[model samples]
Target: MADNKTVRFGLLGCIRFASKFVRTVTQSSNSVIVAISDPSLETAKTFAAANDLSPENVAVYGSYEELLNDANVDAVYLTMPVTQRGKWAVMTAEMKKHVLIEKPPALDATELDKIVEACERNGVQFMDGTIWLHHQRTVKIKETLFDSGLLGDVRHMYTTMTTPVPEQVLERLTKEAMGLAGAIGELGWYPIGAALWAMSYQMPISVRAMPSSVSTNSVGTILSCSASLQFGSTTTAIVHCSFLSQLSTDLAISGSKGSVQMNDYVIPYKEDTAWFEYTSGAKFVDMHTGWNVMPERVTFDCGGTEESQEAMMLREFTRLVEGIKRGDLEADHRWPEISRKTQLVVDALKKSVDIGCEVVHL
Candidate 1:
């Protein structure tokens, strides 16, 4: 068992994002980095050195298996490329170590299922590193908007995340067939996740690819795409993701009596303060002039000694791991359930695009 106050984490792979977690795990109150590993010994050594991780405290391993075998590690933070994450995640879970994986957890729902099953069978916690969901701002929204019924009945949601990538990078992604490297898998995950959250994690009944908006490369890799998710007869969500657009991470939700709009939902524009606009009880003037209420900016402060979303995520996962270790609680199933729901939608959207933009009923 790990320390009662802190969970020891092993870095499973030295991907680019691993650097952030190196700092985050150190900063978190309930977690500490105990090991680091990569396929190349030199790379692992270099990453540890670059991140200022001390060899005296943090063991460096030339191979992932060695890190997994480390008896001191109670959990693992897997930062491998998305395509390789599932297999390693399963391996980590099989070793009875809690696993916190990066976003887009698997190539598809099928693979994600295997990873989650492994975690469940081994009684290890499983969580995806989706930063925004861990933010206090998100919690505030859930309380004030949805839980309080300030937004009323959710009628529709619109989310988009797009950014322009270089031509060569897009070409390389297409050639290599990186799992979900296409706009849909890479960027669409954000919008789809937002939509599901707005809907209280309800599965959409159907998904339809907007063929008119779909863009593909020479090798038929999706460079950009738009899809519609039908939640019910009266509710729908429109999502657009792209690799060839101005940077945007917009989330808008309309309800019977109010609406919420977020321009930087994925990554807050500022680290210290994140804001969203909310308009409630809106109505037109007698003369059909400008409406009565305008969007009110709701700001969430994340400053002071408060942890970043990344660190909070680690702390939360570690708390769960600790509870399980003490036998006071079972591993939290909610995180893996959320990831599975997100992956299912991603699979449906990809299927719709592949089958000539047909409507896929879930």
Candidate 2:
């Protein structure tokens, strides 16, 4: 980086949702699309054209290694499959380029430790692409969580992200050759990350996955699943994610003082404002004849000029990249720590399910 210049973003893997981040990086003032890499140059070119990148400014490569080796590339936004992310992340780290990866990047804690180690050794930044946590709503929500006079001592949280997979995606996911981790690693990761984030990355003492019903494809990939997390005392969280259900994404947090409830936690339905409600006190009126529910609904722009979570996420990531280049000391550890904790809980949930309702200790 030239200190006064935009951070160069080299996008790796031309996945379906790659366009979202591409658009975000282009919109952000701190970042630019310097290069793109995929298995085919045509595919990369198609992506670049869709995102409206200029051929003279953006380089397209058919190989990820070539993109990583490009001198102009400063950081990489990786949108690869869950299983392949670890390999590419380590490679990116060894190459000394900062990494911003999609969620569930680690298959287990062992792999996550290795990825974290590589980045630390190379003095590069590492962050997972969890969208909602970067939103302005999250900032306000964290403030409310600490105000005991408001939401008080958070106790429990429940979140869900269930949406029907497209026909092409369903076929690719269920194929034996792909051998993907199934819906748990795909749609499940967002809500699970939300649950972990609600408690400030506090590791649960134990985890149990208790899905009432399980559906698998013809090739044996799980289509849907759910789990619960125990925080050892009064705190707990539950999450449900699926690939075989209608579109739905929501989260509710309960506390000693009140509760927080909202929909569209994974992605905002609109770009302008978000909706969430909280309640402080409630009671029955006239001998239980009627109920008085004190619910306060909130709607705000959340300071998002780009509107969507992905855009906000990219802006924040780019800011950190530039800040670090300018010698900021407090930027790197925060993202990697959150990413590691999220992956640790996801690994525990999968282990609990595999062992027949056994409680996996974290």
Candidate 3:
């Protein structure tokens, strides 16, 4: 619960995602996007105007430092690139403001540790913007599968996420922006978080990655990854991620009695679809017999004029801001822990790629 009084927010960058976050805050009850800073003044003004925000209500700056120095801001959201996230987290923590950074908080555990320590020392709440952790469907899925144990003893879990790369952004996507680790950073972390939350924080015993390049410069167009995670009592799970082809996402869990499949697991913007199949000796039966067994397709009906990714991210940013102001950060566990474990797997995957797809220990 956020305080009735609004928490003022200053966005560090008016990047594509930041704009969406601003709109989300505007629609929220307990927060306001009071200011924003980017390296481009014209771009900032245009964004403000497009969002129905008065120019006076928004502050445009040519640098991020100015936004950090603003006294009206109670919190800051950093949607910057993964390579630059740690620096901004440290700086924001030092400013005495609550911080919610975009996923893959840092490239590795050591960098994430430094950012976490800085926030702790500064007495500020820190969160990674892994919104699925806050989603109602995810909560229900975990409850039905793990808490109720209705699916029988858990046996295996696997996930895959992939998307086609646009020609204009191919170079940045391959080498600089997120790199292979960073691409997996966003899409991979969600399922990892889901596994950690449902499995009670069990760490994977070993990881192996098979990376293939469709082009030169080691910018592998596709990464076929397999990580074997050993939970207690012989329960094992394998996680997979790739950027090899068209946009497709799926997660399947196998159990003794039945299996549950969550299709389109990573992106909520896509239809939220799932199905359950019960094993009957040699074959399986759809539990919802004769009916559409798929989980109800959920359309992302966001209440905003803008239809960009930034708009979607900003709406959640507002909720997080309100949550911090009211000290309601306990709604989700496994944020910090999942973030750490996700990075560990990603680092291991990178090493596996470097060493010719060898199996690496967790």
For model 3, how does the per-residue alpha-carbon lDDT over 127-184 read when each residue is reduced to its tens digit?
Answer: 7877655554555666765666665777777766666656565555653566556455
* Whole-model alpha-carbon lDDT for candidate 2: 0.79
For model 2, the run of ten residues with the poorest summed lDDT: 172-181
- Please rank every candidate by lDDT, starting with the best: 1, 2, 3
Q: Give lDDT tens digits, candidate 1, residues 1-362.
A: 25577888899889767898888877777778889999998999999899998899999999999999998999998887778888899999999999999888888999999999999999999999888998888888999999999999899899999999888877666524556437777789899999999999999999999989888887877889999999989999999999989999999999998999988998888777888889999999789989998789887777732556776677788789989988988999999999999989989999999899999999
Off by over 4 Å in 3: 1-4, 179-182, 211-233, 269-334
What TM-score does candidate 2 get on C-alpha atoms? 0.92
User: Model 2: how far is 257 from its true place, Å?
Assistant: 1.5
lDDT of each: 0.88, 0.79, 0.64
Estimated TM-score for each candidate: 0.96, 0.92, 0.80
- Model 1 score (lDDT): 0.88
Total clashes for model 2: 0
- Residue by residue across 1-362, what tens digits does model 2's lDDT show? 34445889898898768887887777776778889999888899888888887889899999999999998888998887667778899999898888998887766667878988998998888888878888777767777655445878778888998999876676567534223447766777788788777777778899888856456676667677878888868888888888888998989988887888888877777777887788876567778986677678777785555756777777777777777677774347988888778778777777776677688998
Query: Which is the better candidate, 1 or 2, if ranked by lDDT?
Result: 1
Question: Which model scores highest in TM-score?
Answer: 1
- Identify the candidate with maximal lDDT: 1
Q: What value of lDDT does candidate 3 attain over all alpha carbons? A: 0.64
Alpha-carbon runs more than 4 Å astray in model 2: 1-3, 166-171, 174-180, 302-304
Clashing pairs in 1: none
